[model samples]
Target chain A: MRRAKFKAAAVAFIASATLASATLASAPAQAEIASGAVLANTCFSCHGTDGKSAGDMPTIAGKSEDFITRKLKAFKSGELEATIMNRIAKGFTDEEIAALAKFFSRR
Target chain B: MTELTRRGFNKGLGATTALGALSLSGIAPATAAGKAQVVVVGGGFGGATAAKYIKRFDPKIGVTLVEPSKRFVTCPFSNTVIGGLNTIDYITHGYDALKGLGVEVVHDSAAAVDGAKKQVRLAGGGSIGFDRCIVAPGVDFRWEAIEGLDAGTAARIPHAWKAGAQTLLLRKQLEAMADGGVFVISPPVNPFRCPPGPGERISLVASYFKTAKPRSKIIVLDPKEKFSKEGLFKEGWAALYPGMIEYRNLAEDGLVRRVDPASRTLYTDFGEETGDVVNFIPAQKAGKIAQVSGLADKTEWCPIHPRSFESTLQPGVHVIGDASIAAPMPKSAFTASTQAKVCAEAVVNLLRGAAPGAPKFINVCYSLVGENYGISVAMVYGYRDGRIVKIEGSGGLSPSGATPEFRRKEADYTRGWYESISRDIWG
Candidate 1:
C-alpha cells in the first residue's frame, strides 16, 4: 500500500512538471508576436500601420487588452454592434485574438 | 440532490460562492508575473480595454486577446441607424486599433475555457495556455424562454438587442411598416445591456416616425416597473410624442409568453398584443463562452474581483462589460470603458507585484431623447471593505427637465463623448 501511494505521487509530480514546462515553452512565441513585427500584414487595411485610423476607423495602438477582448467577443456572440467586420471576425479563434492583442499592444 | 444553490453551476462554483476568495487563491494571484501568459476572451468594450490596459501597465507580462471579430460596431450610437441619422458604416471599426497597440487580435470565437487548466480552447481546434485569463464576451439571446421565438422568429420579429445585422433589420422593418400601423417595442428585464437602451431606441424610432410616418403609433412593453431615465422619458413623451407613444409597465404577470411571427402578435402573461411590427428583447445572461468556461453563476453572469474585474472562477481570468456582475453600473459603452480602465489599472498593479490600492470606477451614460434633447448621468466608485460601493448623489438626472439650450448642450457633449470613448478603447 505504501509503495502504491509513492508511485502515484511521483507520477502526479512528473505530469505536473511536464505540463508546466510545455506551458512555459509556448509563452515566448506569444512574446515574439508582441515584440516582433509579424502582424503588420494583417493590419493597415483599416487602421493604417501607425495606429492612425482611416476615415471613421478607430485608433487602437494604446488600448487595454480587456477592452479589445470585450469588443471582439461582441462580434463573436452577435451582441455589441458590427457590420462587415463581424463577417471578417468570424474567422479568428480566441488564441489568435490573444496573439493579435499581444502583438499590437507591444507595437 | 444537493440543491445547486447557484442553480446553474457545478458543485465547485457553489463552494466558491460561499467562499469566493478561497477558489481565487488556487489561481495565480491577479497580475502575478513569472512570465505568466494571460488569455482574454472577447473583443468588445471590456475585452478590448482589458487587453490594451494589461499591456500598458506591464510590458513584460504576456497577454492574449481572444475575440471572434476583427471589427466592432459601436452600440452607443447604433440607434441613429433606425432614425436615419447615420448609417451602419459610420459605427463600424476593425481590430486595427487593437493590432496597432501590439495586441494579438484573433479573429475567431472561443469554444471553451477550462478554468482548471487555465486554458481557453477555440471552436476551431487548438487551445492556448494562460496563467490568467479574462472574458468580456457580451450576452446571448435567450431563445428558449420565449415560446414561438427562436432565431427564425427573431428574424421576422426583429430583436435588435445584439446590434450589427439585427439593428439594421429592425431599421429596415420600421421603414417597411405601414404609415398608420402599430409598432410594438418590448424592453427586457433590467441588468441587461444598456439599461436605457430600449428607451433610447423607442424614443429615436418615435422621432423618426413623427416626421416620416405621422400616423404610426409606438407601444412599449416593459418587464420592469421602472426604467433608467424614467422621469425624463415620461416628461418628453408627454411634451413631444404624446399619444403617438404608449408604454405598459408589465410585471411578472405581464411577461411576454409567446410570439406569433405571421400575425405580428406577442402573447404576454397579461394579454395578447398585436402590431404591424413586434420587437422583443428577451432576458439575457453572459455570453455562451463565459457559461462554457464555468465563469457564470445562477445569474448566467460571471462574478469578478470588484477592482481588477478578474474572474473569481479561474485565476488570471478576468471578466468585464455586459457579462460581469458590475452593479451600480449600467451596461453602457461609457460604463464598460470606465470599468475597463479600472481593470487595466488593477491588472497593471498586479503584474508589477504591487498591491492594488483602492481602485476607482467611473461611468457616464448619455442618451439623446429628441433631435436635440439629451440627458445624462455620471458617477465615481471605489472598493469598500470587500464589496464595491458607489459614491451616492455624485450625479443625477440632467437637472430635472432643464431648458432646451441645456438639453442641446447635453447633446453636444453626447457627441463629443462618443468620439473620445471610441478612441479610448480602439486607440
Candidate 2:
C-alpha cells in the first residue's frame, strides 16, 4: 500500500513537471535549460529518465531551484561528498550548474 | 583513446608498477607562462570537487586531476547497493563531467610529492610541477588487524564497505547463500567511514531476503558495545526483519580474531561464529596516496585547519573527506562533501590572496532502516578556536518514537536529498 502511494505520487510529480514546463515560466533560471540539459546528461545517467528513477532513483524532477543549485554547488564546491556525484558534479560550469538547478527544479 | 595515449606515454617512459604517493608528473614544465598550476590528487569526493572549482573559480588556474582510474564509484548510499536497493552501475560515474568542464584530467598515479619544490613525481617516470595541490585520496584497509585476514582474504570475503564492485561482490554472495544460510556482518571499530552505514546496510539487506530467502538470517559482531541510532535500528529490526538479525558487541571479544574461508567460519574472541557469507569492514585509514604524501599524522588521517582544511604538515595543500581528521562530524559522504565545499572556498581564497575565515560546515546522513522507513542525523558546524564546532540552530536526528508516517517521510526526504545532493555535486 505504501509503495503504491509512493509510485503514484512519483508518477504525478513527473506528469505535473512535464505539464508545467510546457507553459514555460520565464524565470531567469529556467532560460538556461539547454546548457543545463547538456551538463545534466552526466547526472541523467544515474538519476535516470528525467531525474525520476523507476522508484529506485531519487526524483530531481521537481525541487526548489536554489536547493538543487546549492547541492550541485556543494558537490562542485566540495561542500558535499557523494562518490559519483561529487566527481561528476564538480566538472560543471558555473552557468551549467545554475542551469541544472533550474532545469531539475522546473522538471 | 586518451587511455591508449596515456598507456603509450607511461610505457614509453618505461614505468613499471606505479607506486608511492599518488602524483602528477605529466605537467609539461609550465610552458603556459603565467598561469597558476593546480594539481589535484584523488578522483573521489575532495579531489574532484577541488579540481572543478579551481577551473570555474579561475579558469586561468590550470587544474590537473591526477587519479589512478578514469572512472570512480562512490561509497555513499552504496549501502543501497549492498542492501539490494540499487546496482553499482547506477552509482558509478566517470571523469567526462570534469573533462567537459575544461579541467585537465590526468590518468596517472602520484608517485611522490616534492611539496617544498611544489612538484609531483608521476608513476610514468616524469615530474609534474604545481603551484598548489589538493589530496582527497579516500582510504585504505588495515589488513593485519585480524589474525588471518589481509587484502588477499578480502577478495575471498569482501569488506564491500567501500562500495564499487566489492559491494556488489558481497551482495551477490549473500543472495546466493542457502535459504537458511547465516549472513554475518562484522562492523569496523571507531573512526571509520560512515559510522551508521553498516546497521543501515544490514537492515536493508535483510528486507530483500525476507521475501526472497525467508529462511536466511544475519549475525552482526562489532568492536563497540553501543552504536549511533541504536534504538531505532533495534526497534525496526524486531518489528520488521525479526528472527533474521542478531547483534554481538565486541567489548566482550566482539572482534573477529580469525577467519577461514574454506571452512566458511569466523571466530570472535567471545566464541566461534560461522556463516555461509561474511561481510567484514575492517579497520581503515587514509589510502596509500595520502599516506605517501606525508599528509597523515597520528590516527593515520590528515590534520588540517578545520576552517580551511589545509594540511598541517604541508602548505599549498588541503585534505578533506575520510582522509582528514574532521570531528564534530561523522565520516560520511555528506560531511566529506560539506568539507570539500569549505575547502574549496578556502582554497579559492588562498589562491586569490584573500582571507578564509570561520567557514561553516554542515552534515545530514539518512539511512533506510527498512523499506520506506528511514532515519537520519543532521548538524551544522563552524570552526571555532581552532576546532570544528557544531552550530546550535542547525541539526538534529530523526525524531524518536514518531509515527510510521514520519519514518516514511524521512524515506522520501532521503531520496529527495540524494537527488538534491547528486545534482549539487554532479549536475
Candidate 3:
C-alpha cells in the first residue's frame, strides 16, 4: 500500500512538473529557474528528500525562506554550530543558497 | 515526441486536474524531447548514483549501467563486519532500485571502451553505443608494490580492502587466531582509497578484542608518518582500547618491504615481524578497465576536468570515484557519490549543447572508533582557475576533547549517514 501511494505521488509530481514546464515554454524567461532538485539530490545523501529529516537531522521543508537563508549563510560564515552543515553550506554560492531556500520553503 | 509536447500543452487545465489524469492513467511524462544514451561502467556508488540522477534529470536520456556483479558490497561499513558487529548481507545491495528508475542495469563487465566509435565492449563479446561514457570503476591494487603479495598470497594474507570475500577471510583469520595473538596490519602509502579506512578497521578490531579476545594485540605498520584522523584515532585507541593497539609510523621503520605468506611474516627495512593474522593493504591505482580503456594515463589515475569530471585524456568520457585523480578531494565514497551528481548534470547539459555548470563538491567521511564512538572529517570544494580548491573554513575534524556523550552522538550520526547514503545510492 505504501509503495502504491509512493508511485501515485511520483506520477502526480511528474505530471505537475511537466505541466509547469509546458506553461513556462512560451515564456522562456520564467523557464530560467535554477534546477534546485538536481542540486538538492546531493543533500538527500544525509537529509531526506525535499529536506525532510529521517533521523536526528532537522527538517528544513516548509521552513520560512528567511530562516533557511539565515541558517545557511550562518553555516557558510562559520557562525553556526554544525557537525556537517557548515562544510556542506560552504559548497553553495549565495545564489544557490537562496535558490535552495526558496525551493525548500515551498516543500 | 510530439505527443509529449502536446501533453505538456494541456497545461491550460488546472494542475490538480492534470495530476488526476496522470495518476489514473499511470503514465510518466517523457523526460525530454531528445533521447541520448549514457553508458556507465561499474555500478558502485559513483556509477549507480550517476545513472539514477541522469534518469531523474532527463528520463529521455537512456542510461545503461555496466557492472559485472549483480549485487554490490560496500566498503564503507565492511569493517563492522570484520569486527562481527554487522553481517556481510547488511552492506550488500542490488541494482533493482536503479532499474526502477528506468536505468538499464547490465550485469556484464565493460571489457574495453572505443573512444572514437563511442562504444563500450562487454567482456561477453558485444558492444553498446553511447553518446557519453562515465566510468567509475573503483581502485585496483598495484600487485608488484610489495614482494610476494599477489592474488594467491592475498587470499592467505587478506587485504580486506575491497570489502567482500577478503573481508570474510580477514574475519576468519581473526576468529581462528588464539588469544594473545598479534594481528599485524600494513597500511599502504598516501593517494589510496579511503584514507581513514585502515585506522577505523584497527579501532573496530580492537573493540572486538576488548570483549572476545582480551589478550590479543593489534600492531599497525603504517608507511606514512601520519594518517587521516590520526589524532582522533590515537585518542580513541588510548581511551577505549588501552594497551591494545600500537602504531608504528614510517620514521620508526614501519614500512613493509616484503611479505612471506607461508611464514605469515612481514619484512621491513628495520627487521622482520610475524603475526597470527596479517592484513597487507597494497598501493592502489585506477581499475584495470580504466587503464585498458585509455582513460588513465601514466599517472595510473584518470585526470578529469574539475567542473565536469570529464576525462582530460579522453573526450566524451568521464571518470570518477577512486579511479579519478580528484586532488584535494580524497578518493572516498562520499566524494564519489557527490562527483556522480555533478557529472550527471554535466552529461545532461552537454547532451543539450550547453556548457556544463560550475560544480560544488562536498565530502564527509565518518570513522567509528568504537561501537558507540565516531569521528569525522568533512570538506567543501569548488573548481577555481584550473583545479579543485577547498573552500577555507568550510570543514574540519570532529572537535577534540569532547565528552563521551558527544562521541556517542557522532556515532549515531555515523550510522544515520550510512543508512541515508546507502539508500540514496541503491535504495
Candidate 4:
C-alpha cells in the first residue's frame, strides 16, 4: 500500500509538472484564439458549446467563414428575415462578428 | 476525491517524498508558484459553468467545486414540471461531466470563507485553500421579511423557487386542489431572481387549470406596477384564458404582508384572502454563505468589478449569478451561465498575470404563454462607466401582436435554449 501511494503521488507530480510546462509553451497560441473564444462563448448558451446547436437553433459550427460573416452582417443590416437573430446581430461590431465567424468556422 | 486521496497519500509518505510531491504538484500548504488553484462555491449555472470553463481555458489550473447536491434540479423549465408539461428528471442535471473535465467535485456545502487566509471552510470539517475563489451562491430569502413565514412554515406553502421537492410539492398541491378553486401567487418586489418568473408561473398554472380543471381561477397579486413582457402576457392571457386570471397591482393592495400557512391565508394591506394553493415568493438577498461571509452589502447583493466580476469587498474572490449586483442583467440561467464564462476567462487571465478582455453579455428570456405559445424579451449588454448597461436600440420585447406561428416558433426555441444551455453548463 505504501509503495502504491508513493507511486501514485509521484505520477501526479510528474503529470502536473508536464501539464504546467505544456500550458506555458502554448500560451501564445491560446492568446491568438482567446478573443474569438471569448466572443463566441456567449453564443454557446443558445447555440451549443463550440457553436453546435443541440436543438432547433441552426448549428454554426463547421460553416465557412464567409458564410457566417455574410449571414451575421445581413442579420445586422436587417436584410435577413429572422425572429431573434436580427436583434442579437445588431449588438455585435464588424470586428466582433468577424472574430465569431472565424472561431465557429474553425470549430 | 482527488484532493482527498492526495491528502491521505501525503500523510503516509516520507517527509522528503511528500515535500517533493507537494512542491511539484503545487498542492496545499501555499500557492507554491506552479499550478493555479481555484475554489468555486455552489454548483448551479454560475459555479458549475465557471468550474468547467476555467478548466477548459487552462487545464493546468486546479479547480475544486463545492456543492451540496449530487444532482441539481434547474429552475428554468421547472414551471413545466408544475404545469405537467415535463418531468423533474428532464430538468435535473448531474456533475459527472464536470468531473470528467478533471475538476475536483467536492460534494460539501461551504460554511464560510476566510478571505484573509484564502481558504474556504467546509461544513464537512476540513478547509480547502485557493489562490482565488469564485462565489456563485445564488439567492436566499429574507425569512424575517415576512411574518409567519419561516423555513418550517414554507413546507406547507411551497415557494418552489429552488426547484426540487418544492417543485413537486407545488405540482401535487395543484393536483389536489378542487375544481373552480383559487390559486394565488404573490410575487415580490424588484431585483428578485427571474423577474418574469411569476408571470410565467401564472401562465403555466392557468394552462394546467384550463385543461385539467377548466373552471379553476388564478389570482396574481404583484407588488410591481408593471412586469416583464406585460403587454405580451396580457394579450396572451386575454386570447387564451380570458377572465380566468385576475391580476392586482400594488395600488390595488397587492403586496403580501403575512401568511397563515395552516389556513392557506394571505393578509394584504387591503384585507385577507385565502387560496386552496399558495406560492408566496418572499423578498430575497444574496445566498446564505455570501450574506454571512460579509460579501453582501446593505442592499443584500455583492458589488463586483464590472469587467472581472471580482467582488469589490473581497479582492481575490469573484461573485457571479443572481447574488451579484449586475443591474441591466436580470437574474436568469442564461445570464448566470454567460457570466460564468466571462468570470472564468477573467480568473484565468488574472492568474496568468494578464488583463481580462472586455466582455459583452446577452440575455434572451422566453416565457411560455402556453406550451405552444411563447413570448420573449432579449437584451445585449456592454460594460460602460463602471456598470453593465444595455446597448441602445439593441434589444426589445417580441412584437406586440404576432401570428400564432410566431409564438409557436418562439416556444420551440425556448425548449432549444434550455437544452443547449443545460448542455453547456453541465453536459
RMSD of each: 15.0, 13.9, 10.1, 11.3
iRMSD per prediction, in order: 15.6, 17.9, 9.9, 11.0
Task: Write candidate 2's Cα lDDT for B1-427 as tens digits.
Answer: 1223322322321121111112333332232236777788877766776676666555667788898876677777777787788877767778877887878888999887667678888898897877667888778888777767788887778998776778888888977888888888888888888888888988988987887788888888888888878888888888788788988886666778888876768897658887889888888998787788898897888887675677878766778888888887788777776676566655554443333422445466778887688887766564445577765544556656778877787776667666555545554
Best by lDDT: 4
Q: Which stretches in model 2 have alpha-carbon errors above 4 Å?
A: A1-107, B1-33
Better of 1 and 2 by lDDT: 2
Q: lDDT tens digits, residues B135-236, model 1? A: 788888777877888888778888888768988998888999889988998888867898878878888888999999999998887778889989887787
Q: C-alpha displacement of B75 in model 3, angstroms?
A: 0.3
* Shift in Å, residue B96, candidate 4: 0.5
Query: Per DockQ, what order, best first?
Result: 4, 3, 2, 1
Residue B416, model 4: Cα distance from true site in angstroms: 0.1
* Cα-based TM-score, every candidate: 0.74, 0.74, 0.86, 0.89
Output the better candidate (3/4) by TM-score: 4
- Best by TM-score, which number? 4
Measured by TM-score, how close is model 3 to the native structure?
0.86
Task: Tell me candidate 4's interface RMSD.
Answer: 11.0
Q: Which stretches of candidate 4 lie over 4 Å from their true place?
A: A1-33, B1-32
